[model samples]
Target: MIADPEGTVLALFAAFCRIGACIMVLPGFSSFRVPVQIRLFIAVAVSMALLPVMWDSIYPRVQGGGSNYLLLVGVEMLIGVTMGLIARYIVLAMQFAGTGISMAIGFNAAPGGGLLEAEPEGHITAFISFTVLFVLFLSDFHHMVIAALVRSYSFMPVGADFDPRMALMTLTDTLAGAFMLALRLASPFLVYGLIFNLSIGMVNKLSPQIPVYFISIPFILFGGLILLYFGSQSFFTLFVNGFEPLYLGLP
Candidate 1:
């Protein structure tokens, strides 16, 4: 095919804009460690590879006045950002679960940086979140993300009026799911904390002079660690399983 220099360059730039927006927030790609140059190159490459297929659909919509081109580009960026955030929420849910578990087990100290962020997290919760994210990548869950990106064009074409209702609904549903998943992952810790607390309360009642706070704190921490070691794999498996359905539902 004869190359039309102007069309080719515009198409590439449009694709780059769409993809750069996506990589900026998408999990894995969004990680702090990924150098900006590498991310830029990947975005450009992916956009270009997909360009021929998307050009006919995207270009016509973006052409005309410069203002119209900018508007279309902004809409594409919005679509990419929305999808990336939705996928990233799954990881956030796992982190939230870790935080909840930490609070329950008495390891409420702040979490160290690595997988999710440098903020405080329950030790086990952090571990589980990191593990689940790793497994998601290993299991080829990212393929679903690429599929969704392609499918998004059909529902949210370039130059079409952006729908705030769908975006709001997407955020609400994903956030709700993330919270529920966090609670589910931390259920074991929750149960352990409840039983341990109840038993400690009874002991305190029986012996008023005993200092239960210091003693029970260590006991709960140890028990939580043990439970985490044993149950984490299963918890992450369930988490990854849950992610699949939620991801497929995204527009």
Candidate 2:
């Protein structure tokens, strides 16, 4: 038989690897601004705290060095990635909203950094996306993510093969729901931009000499700012509320 202490340590290390990999990509914890060393340290600390509590359940299965070991590791990775992807979709909802708002407000013309890598997005859209992501961390929603991580082992134990078809379907459904939520959040801005532009166009046609584009630019800017200020509280509340459901569903 393998030594008890060595087996325990290996199990803990394996668990930490899975958790760390997930956090590396999960929302709230996966910020480019955070130093990699700090993230690794946090992951290690979390795994250490959890190992003792979870060892009774996870140790027996992982003790033996055989085919089961590889299978368990794979399951752990799949569970971790699924959980992270669920959280990621929640953040994507915000990005979708930001993109919609930017397009409606005529700010989509300006170029900015991509959301992940090489995915082109507008400047205003990028700003809103980053702000929402930052706010998620600031609000301590990351605690929910960690909780989900710990809870996942219970729902999806080691050595059990997950259904890849179900995983794919879940991802697809989550993304579609996220996009729909974004559209809802940005609908007010879209409607306002539409109506305002239509009215301006009518006025310009009525008096072709007038410089309607120059005149209405300031109005639209001020209107958008005021709308954002008023809508921000609702937006954050909606995002947090929506995020909880998605987090809970991840397996």
Candidate 3:
């Protein structure tokens, strides 16, 4: 059964190239906290597991080694990265919303460590980001992503023609969707901040001697925190619900 060990090994690496690249930029798997060795091992293990299913398509290509093989490998990387970016953009959108929510709620503070990157984030923003990521994990996001990848082979086979225009369009659409989602999630905070600040600004004009602005901080913080406490569960639920349709349901 294992007559062509070298051929099988080459095919395996070919599969690994794509999968490993995807894991490099995938959301939870790509976090700075996840060690490189662990990610590499996961990629290899996934490639091996998937090799049997993809063998018919990939083995023939590997057998004919040369420019075509190299090109196929390159295309696989492109496809993997593109798929990873689709999901990554969604996560970034949530992080963007977290940042905006913090600003709106007057919770600005010294930047804390990022949940997925080196970039600093507000304390509350970091909390929200990590919590949502945890929820995604519990929801078996990885299984969904891998399933999507398996399905991708049917539509975008190895060494498929890369369409830059189509890719750009998809990126633009994702950005637009992400922007809209972020805005929706943060809208309540925006409205509350606006009303609170306006009322305080007017009070300051009327009673400039009362230090109205200074006194408003505690109340603003209290009200914003209360709103966040009540709204967080629903907010995360909406995000989780939308993520699958937006990325996995792609035509």
Candidate 4:
């Protein structure tokens, strides 16, 4: 028979508070296309599976069952959300770089619906975002997140006070790191665009009679496309390589 069913239940919910909140904002799991019910079930299932493994850590903390328990719940959720945001911020940085690439290369075509998000995105942005997401899944990034979740209790145990300042600093660092990685990925295209535009401007100055701006558009667009096609492999490789460092570096 079960002993102290109430304590067990509390522990399970406590575990869910962390895991569920993380999944709620996690990149692929939090996509608009995923149903809320599916997310809920996935969270609950993972919580249950982990409960046994974490029993020693979680059950003792919640056995008291008082106002203190409420504080733990809130802290757990906050930690979960913070961790999820770390990953979310990185993916967002990639999207920002994609937008930059689109602008730099003169691919300002009208945006269409995004593959993962509800918001409309330019074709180049959408493609880059989707591809990055795809590569992340292919490399089992979710596994890393789950592993990190399990290890979290060791450092951020239950009943510990949530430190907003530390969380803020961690997020700020994540943003800075993510921005640097995005800039690295987009640097080549940015340089290419600058050189291409400068050359075209010189050509226009030499022959003011011709409509240089209109004529140069096709060449720049073609060159940008060619550059993207050739460099796509390196671009994604670097992105995947950098992701682990940024994520693991979080405090």
Cα lDDT tens digits for candidate 4, 1-251: 78899999999999999999999999989999999999999999999998999899999999969999998999999999999999999999999999999988999899999988999999999999999999999999988988889999999898889999999988999999999999999999999999999998998889989898789889888999999999999999999999998988833
Which candidate leads the pack in lDDT? 4
Ranking by TM-score: 4, 3, 1, 2
In model 2, what lDDT does residue 2 have? 41
lDDT (Cα, tens digit) per residue for candidate 1, span 133-192: 789889887678777777777877767877889998997899888788778878889999
- Residue 93 displacement (Å), model 4: 0.5
**TM-score for each of the candidates:** 0.91, 0.87, 0.95, 0.97
After superposition, candidate 2 runs with Cα above 4 Å error: 1-3, 112-123
Better of 2 and 3 by lDDT: 3
Candidate 2 lDDT, 100-214, residue by residue in tens: 7876666646576675435677776777777778677777877877777777778677667877887788788888777777777888999999999999999999999999988
Higher-lDDT candidate of 1 and 4:
4
Score candidate 3 by lDDT: 0.85
Question: RMSD (Cα, Å) of candidate 4?
Answer: 1.2
Could you tally the backbone clashes for each prediction? 4, 0, 0, 0
How would you encode candidate 3's per-residue C-alpha lDDT over 43-156 as one tens digit per residue? 999999999999998887788577887888888888888888888898888888888888887887889888778888888878877887888899998888888788888888
- Model 2 is weakest, by summed lDDT over 10 consecutive residues, at 108-117
Query: How big is the positional error of residue 198 in model 4, measured in Å on the Cα after superposition?
Result: 0.6
Q: RMSD for each model, in Å, please?
A: 2.1, 3.0, 1.5, 1.2
Enumerate residue pairs that collide in model 2.
Answer: none
Worst 10 residues of 3 by lDDT: 242-251
